[model samples]
Target: MQDPNTLCRRAVEYLEEYRDSQRHLRADGVGRSVGDVWKPPPNSIFKLNFDATVFVEAKRTRFGAIIRNDKGAVMAAMSTGGPPMSSSEEAELLAGRKAVEFATDVGFSELVIEGDNRNVMKALSSSLDDRSLLGNVVDDVRHLVYGMHWINFSCIRRGGNRVAHALVQHARNISEDVFWLEDSPPPALNALYQDSLLL
Candidate 1:
């Protein structure tokens, strides 16, 4: 359908049914549910840009995100991670959910998700339901995003997600204890990239 709302709504419903077949974490253990946040007040506006770094060597996933206003200056930037699952799709969804959690944790009440994973973006816009071949990871992501705002998933290319992309590149090569900035590599990432040192 040309109507994005109707499409997203159907996908949400399919996701809910998928979640129903899965186990729920005890209420306290599930980090913050997306329900705690406020929906856009009818037509309110906000945007969240997100991306994930998947490392083949360590099988890790690191997500980076930024919240921006209409003018596009960033209001928030964050990074989070967990072990990677079987498919790139799972990594993408995990990144999306954690980014949303970070936004709500800091009181963002209205937002849409932006990411480079076309797979998850397409799934969020369609009613088709099947394991992402990623299993519970998909359900966990769906559960985390059950409510809050006119949350639409927009597909972007990696180059368009520069800030978050940079973070993921760093996460893949840098040690956990280090941080870097502004085109300057962390000493650790620098060394690893050179193949002169073991990370």
Candidate 2:
């Protein structure tokens, strides 16, 4: 198994590769759209944007989640590390679960859980049972959703998930899970501010 330091280094490298790919896609105008900007949730509701990075070679995964009020102000944020994942889809499913867990722990009931993984979001919002390899994780998230007063699953482009992405990337340097209440971490502050600009 790779040491934590080595895993962190790999995480940073993977993040850079992902960013490069996104840049190339944008330059090709393949995924650019007006809706790429993050939007605030409705009044009395909170938006939780979550993202995850899988270091398959390192047998590890990292996920970050941010909760914001209708004004787009950060209410809480978290960066957490987890065990190995076989696929990005599994990683995303786990991320969504972690995000929901974080939000509920922070006392949020009305929520819009957003992520960049279209397939995961679709499965999450669907009423049908999931039987894939990641079905258990999906079921876990759905069960959490049932406990909420109101909840919605939304899929947005990666560009719109910058703040959460930044948080996941920032997880590289930490040895343990980190949580911020009523504040945004320094690495995500700029992205958080940029998101508020669109509100």
Candidate 3:
């Protein structure tokens, strides 16, 4: 057996190494991207990218959400359908809320919530009371944020959110909600691979 003192020293060294890696990740920006590429979150933090598409012919909205770790590995992904939305912005807002709920359901507390819709992201990051038609949904998201230990809201270009977009497209064919834990469906796997190339 190893000496007790040696084991203690090794444990402390491992912890220091982990702390340094976390610092490095934070310094690099949690989820900030370079141009229009998807970026991973900092160590121990997950990034949830969400999107929504309006199926006007079906009179419904499809929401897609994908949660990935710092290594760009999908931890959880979901493609779900919702009631018809009058506007795209409203659909985006609802998708954001559903994404948050999905993350929490999967037991993630530290998250960087990302979306391609600027208007929805702006409303989510704002402290001012939203009095628009979708204000209630925005409030629901804010309430969910309070339950998280750490959370950040970010707006990225559509290119950076291709996986989620693909999932939304996949939702068009499925009749029921679909979820993948620690994995992604075929539609999103290609985009996931493309995004990881930059990582």
lDDT of each: 0.58, 0.87, 0.91
| Candidate 2 vs. true structure, TM-score | 0.82
Q: Which stretches of candidate 1 lie over 4 Å from their true place?
A: 1-44, 127-130, 173-199
Ranking by lDDT: 3, 2, 1
Residue-by-residue lDDT tens digits, candidate 3, 1-199: 9999999999999999998976665553346557468889999999999999999988889999999999998899999998898899989999999999999999999999999999999999999999988899999999988989999999999988999999999998889999999876788887886786567
Q: Compute the lDDT of residue 194 as modeled in candidate 1.
A: 22
What TM-score does prediction 3 earn?
0.82
CA RMSD of each candidate after superposition: 20.7, 14.4, 8.8
lDDT of 1 by residue, 1-199 (tens): 4799999999999999777644342232244334322122123556776677667678777776666555443556665566766667777777777777777766676677777788876765454564656545556555555666556667766544555665565556544622222233332233223221110
Model 2 scores what on Cα lDDT?
0.87
Candidate with more favorable, higher TM-score: 1 or 3: 3
Error of 2 at 31 (Å): 11
Error of 1 at 47 (Å): 1.5
lDDT (Cα, tens digit) per residue for candidate 2, span 96-189: 9999988888899999999999999999999999998888888998888888999988999998999999998888667899999997688898
What lDDT score goes with residue 115 in model 1? 78
RMSD of 2: 14.4
